[model samples]
Target: MTREEREQLLARYTTGELTPLERERLFTEAMNDQELFEHLFEDDALEEALSDPAVRRHIMNTAPAPAPAWPLRWRWPVLAGLAASLVLAVILIQRQLTPSSDRSDEHTSELPSPCLLLSPL
Candidate 1:
């Protein structure tokens, strides 16, 4: 790959955003190119302060850590499903509680229409 492409791949690889194949290509290119290997740390303090004990110790300590394992991968999905079900249930209950026109007959017995009340008056 060209220098620009390699740089992009290197960035992605460093950030853990590269695909497996892209990571393979990046490592292969870095191995083949001594200058590129040096260039990877060209701007970082690792190149200038690498000889210092403190710097070396910090580098060893601060190396990128592994990804943390999740306890349950389906936890988020389960919660989302539960939230959706709750919302749906709330909507259904609200619709049921709000009297519909179809049930007007039942309401008319207790709360007569104004026209019906006025007819007697």
Candidate 2:
């Protein structure tokens, strides 16, 4: 592409006006054409170019939209399952913490210390 063509392409790209095909072609050409690639950065550091919010926004707008993580149909079921598990966990924890009438407090209190069980008598 001529210098004018390159400039025009870059201009469109910066405005987020390039079609997907045009964007792909621009990227492919930039990879293959050294002059076009240098024109992209204009001798500036990659970091410097990205640091400009306008440049970052333009780049983000020009990129392809990402696919959704999963279908919406599955979302509610998964959330409900997680909530059920959480309730079950809380119930189990509460049961463990409650003092049961079946075991006497005296029986629990008179048990040898764990450290004594581990050490020599």
Candidate 3:
């Protein structure tokens, strides 16, 4: 099916407006298109959530407050610092997870005894 036709069918399906044949055709297409199926599943979930008054109330109650405005100079410095820190963290994590011969030996080796060193001395 064409992308436009699939989208129109999906819209109708989401709105509970699809005829049985259209619904069946959409389902058949969904079987072939994983991304489309996931989108339709999310839309169905959203529709169900909106239909429930309790879920709507909870979402509204728990919504985060908007961020306060900051000066451009302050914002740029803070954002740059955060981005640098994030990059550093990712690099460190990657290094730790990737096995290098030297790093693996350091991690696995036990410390030598102080007494053994003193005796040699």
Question: Who wins the TM-score comparison?
Answer: 3
**Model 3 Cα lDDT, one tens digit per residue, 1-121:** 9999999998888778999999999989999999999998989899899889999999999999877777667988898999999999999999988989997688668766456435644
1-121: candidate 1 lDDT, tens digit per residue: 8989998887776566988888778778878899877766563445469868898999899999876576478789989999999999999999999988868877788885566445654
The model with the greater lDDT, 1 or 2, is 2
**Candidates ranked by TM-score:** 3, 1, 2
lDDT of 1 at 13: 60
TM-score for each candidate, following the candidate numbering: 0.32, 0.32, 0.52
C-alpha local distance difference test of each model: 0.79, 0.82, 0.89
Query: Is 2 or 3 the stronger prediction by TM-score?
Result: 3
- Looking at model 2, report the run of 10 residues with the lowest lDDT sum: 112-121
Model 2 agreement with the true structure over 1-121: per-residue lDDT tens digits? 6768767878898767999988887878899888778876673467588989999999999999887889889999999999999999999999899978766777888888776345656
Q: Which stretches of candidate 1 lie over 4 Å from their true place?
A: 39-121
Q: Clashing residue pairs in candidate 1, if any?
A: none
Instruction: List residue ranges in candidate 2 displaced over 4 A.
Output: 1-66, 105-121
Most accurate candidate by lDDT: 3
Give the clashing pairs for model 2. Answer: none
